[model samples]
Target chain A: MATKKTIAIIGASGNMGSAIAKSLANAPYRILLFGKEEAKLKSLFKEIKNTNKKADAEIIGCAADASWEADIIIAAVPFAAEKDIAEKIRQVATGKIVISISNPLNETYTGLVTSSDTSSAEELQKLLPHSKVIKAFNTTFAGDFSQPVINGKTIDAFIAGNDEEALETVSDVVRSAGFNPIKAGALAVSRTLENMQSLLIQLSIKNNYNQVAGWKILHN
Target chain B: MATGILLFQSITVILYYNNMYEVLFENVSKKIGLTKEEEQLLQTFFIPKKLRKKQYLLQEGDVSKYLAFVEKGMLRSYTVDEKGIEHIAEFAFEGWWMGDQFSFLTGEPSKYNIDALEDSELLLLTKQAEDQMLEKIPKMERFFRLLLQNHLIAIQGRLASSLSNTAEEKYNQLVQACPTIPQRVPQHMLASYLGITPETLSRLRKNISLRK
Candidate 1:
């Protein structure tokens, strides 16, 4: 058998990270969990183990160490922490796919903190110039991950990356996690994908959706 | 009539239970000795499935969730290119294992398609189940490691032969390895596997027999 690809989730104790981890628990990848809070990481690891005894995962203490060992690194932390995490793992992340799922929402969650000119993934690509930064999973709410389906339709995971291979890889990961992956375009298209998420969050708040809302493109 | 039907079904079940598990156990025994208890424990993790001829075991774009151990009959793995030409990858007879290892290990879509060439019985092992079995029986882990090593060697040898051998030499090697393949698989399929035309394979066969 070919060796399993290792995926490092930098903020694995957080809502988005844990959700992604749990969804991929049964998948064949070797997952490396890294979080600022050791206790939270431990509990999350335990929970994952309880659910699936065969989950190949390790609770890594250092983000850089995890990034160094991983084939793909996911920056699952908040937008504010993405820059710091990027700096920490910049050298290790070179030539690897760094997934940016952050929306960079401003306080009150009304709008994006990133200027209209650039998306969070574009900024992350600048931070780790050698790493292939792919924008994905930003439009879907954390709560929606558990089901990834609404009214018999699976959620659409819009992915954007400068590297074609990186985009394909992220699309595979997204599909494995039960979402319908839509390859939006090049990394620059992340600007629109990120804004789409901000709009979804705003609409969900304005209504009473309770974060259960997700994006799905209807087609024949 | 109902009683007769019930008796027939029961007999079929009994035969299935005896043959499939026995084949798997015998195969494992060839690699490493297993105690009766260990044998019983190992059986719990495998799921027995049957496929009719031409039924797909796996398809392109689907993740291979199980490593199938052939208990009876034959199966083949192949790929269809962009132009829709089918390229045969490997064939599995009884006691052989078949799977898209990359897809099975990484949860990625397989490029190959596996389908039964004959009515077949298979014992399937999922990644999770295999892990539990290995943890429960460390000896099985060694057995698997040896199996993998042997598989690797065979694949490497095949790669070398494919690169260096002529079509006739390749056919000779294939028949030397599995003498029954020509009779078991369709001629065209065998020709495809050897990267030759059916006409060439027929010509080669006639020449080989004439030489003999």
Candidate 2:
């Protein structure tokens, strides 16, 4: 196992954020669950403790804002809170990769309401010019993400950001969760890559299908 | 016969921008860089249209026959779900393109209801004109391609933001980008565009005001 990086998820109480923390429990690292609802974080931390698999890293619970800088921060905030969170993260998160896992959909989750011209990630990048902001994990839903499928087929996940190293770090986290991370050029491509996933999901659901069913990356 | 001819011509050109040629030519020069002859030719192929407030430029289950340049006034593209709730997909102001791109490209009915936000004027293009341009104005093909590319890129970026940003952040950014959008569009409509309930939007605005 790779030496576990001390990773903290900012919005630990949310579905997506908690799913990430749970999935990575056995991966051998100190996991910090931070949230505004400290009681919720403590409760989840307590559940993971009951599992007896013995969390590999120091599993601590804290109640700091997810957007606030603290080591490696994985932001799983709601789309509306993303920019402010990024700004908050940038303030204290220095010289570290800050991962953004958000999907900017209209209120109905129907189609994109924002980026039809520019992206939330680009907006975040502008807001947090220094933080190595990477867009990942937002593509998959919490239902499917609770457990990364162990089936023979590897899932495709799009990863993009300005910093290659930060992108690599995110890839490791994805790989740790048992999915393939696709490197799609610079951060600009994040516009299409992230937004297209919304359409793909909507189409999949419209077709009475699961996004995970049609979701596959060609390895060739 | 003379009176009939004048009346017939009037219907064909009804409410069409009389200075359509001038306005579109100027836009083409700035945006797509059309030469004088190309500009004139492009102008001849297009017609001007005026949409009254809340009128349909395109509707759900209708084929998108025209791609319009907003010469003046505001428009919005939205879709109504089974519950008859209007979901605002996009807002087009002066000098923007608004159409059901899927319907426009595939010749299918759009799943959206696009309407004029206010009485508006547009420089319209038909599928026939686009195909004709693809053949006659080969150089112009690049312009349309670039337009689609940029639109695609913009849509993509929005998805990323949807995943990444919060409502307040997105709204603040929208205000910064357009500056006048919140004031121009109704609060509920703006809330719909933000993928939030009108209640949430109210609270968000209240929070921002408090901060100020």
Candidate 3:
């Protein structure tokens, strides 16, 4: 049998982190979970194992020993902690495909903390230049990750990255997790994607979108 | 002659009502599986209304009484700035819903003014009526929720465009998303919708044509 690919989800206790873990519970990959809170990571690991009885993939949880050898690293940390987490993982995550879902929304969320010209993904890329960074899942709510279909249509996950190879790998991961991955463009396009999340958040608060909604691209 | 006019009006009203029901039934059924009986039940809450061209469906100080759904023609919702310049927020056409949600929910004075761009047909449901319908038919709640979700997604896209895109890019995106918008809406209103001056829109159009 071929060796299973490893996907390391950092900050695995948070809402987004846990939701991604749930979506990948039965996937054909070794799920490596990392978090500051050991107890929470252990609990999530147990839940993933219980949910997927036919699970052949190794599910490992760690606090100090972060898995650097994983094929993919998901930065599921909050926006404030994005820099800190990236700095911590920079050396270990060198040359690996890193997926960022951070939205640099201001405290009020009426605006973005990061400049509209550059994105949170770009900022992270500057911090860790060696790692191939891709922006995705920022526009999707945790509620969307719960189910593949909303109103009988598959939710579209828009992704942007500079590296063609890295984006293709992430697209495969997105498909494995039951979403239609849409290649939006290069890494610079993350500005639009991140801004979209801020806008979606504001609309959700003002109009009661309630996080159950996501975007879908329909082709003619 | 007066009697004949009345008879014609009655038949037109009947046909309009049937069209309204058909649009609503299909829109709701596509989202949530609805039976014919449930669609009939859903039809009772809507009250049909007509607006002549330039007629105001809602004004700034009026507490919005109904969530208006468009069955025919176009309506524009906008707000006037302190300088009396209008900023168009949204345009609703066939099978679209438009209302001042804040005013409808809170009974407060609205900041928006909605006016018919053409002779328009509308179906209105008050908050109480909508609530009662949802209580009677729970599936309709899902339908409305999905509708709001779609609207939110579109609004988010517009917001993103405004924040990051240039005027020309915004115009291109708007046309790409709604191909008929530029054809149906007047250029001035299109400029307003894009948050640009009419002159800028004209220049952009000239530039685009020159490039072609």
Candidate number with greatest lDDT: 1
Worst 10 residues of 2 chain A by lDDT: A62-71
Residues A1-220 of candidate 3 have per-residue lDDT tens digits of 2224567788788888888877876787667777777777778777887888765334445421243436588888887898888755654454567899998888888878887689889988888776789998888888888776888999899999998878998998888888899999999999999888888888888889788777888889
Model 1 per-residue lDDT tens digits across residues A1-220: 3335678999999999999988877788778999988888999999999999999888888887687667689999998998899877775565578999999899998888888899899899999876789998898888988888899999998999988877888998998888999999999899999889889988998897999889878779
Q: Using Cα atoms with residue i matched to residue i, what is each candidate's TM-score against the true structure?
A: 0.53, 0.47, 0.49
Docking tier of model 1: it is incorrect
* Model 3 agreement with the true structure over B1-212: per-residue lDDT tens digits: 99999899868745634675567677777888977788766766665555558867787877787798988888999999999999999999888899988899998888899989988777778787799899999998898899989988988999998999999999998888778888889999999999999999999999998999
Name the candidate, 2 or 3, with the larger TM-score value.
3
Query: Residue B197: error of model 2 in Å?
Result: 70
lDDT of 2 by residue, B69-148 (tens): 88778999888888989888899888788888788989887788788888776766777667876787677777777778
What is every candidate's C-alpha DockQ against the true complex, given to 2 decimals? 0.01, 0.01, 0.01
Under CAPRI classification, how is model 3 graded?
incorrect
Pick the DockQ winner. Answer: 1
- Candidate 3 positional error at A190, Å: 0.5
Q: After superposition, how far is residue B71 of candidate 2 from its true place, in Å?
A: 60
Docking class of 2: incorrect
TM-score of chain A taken by itself, candidate 3: 0.92
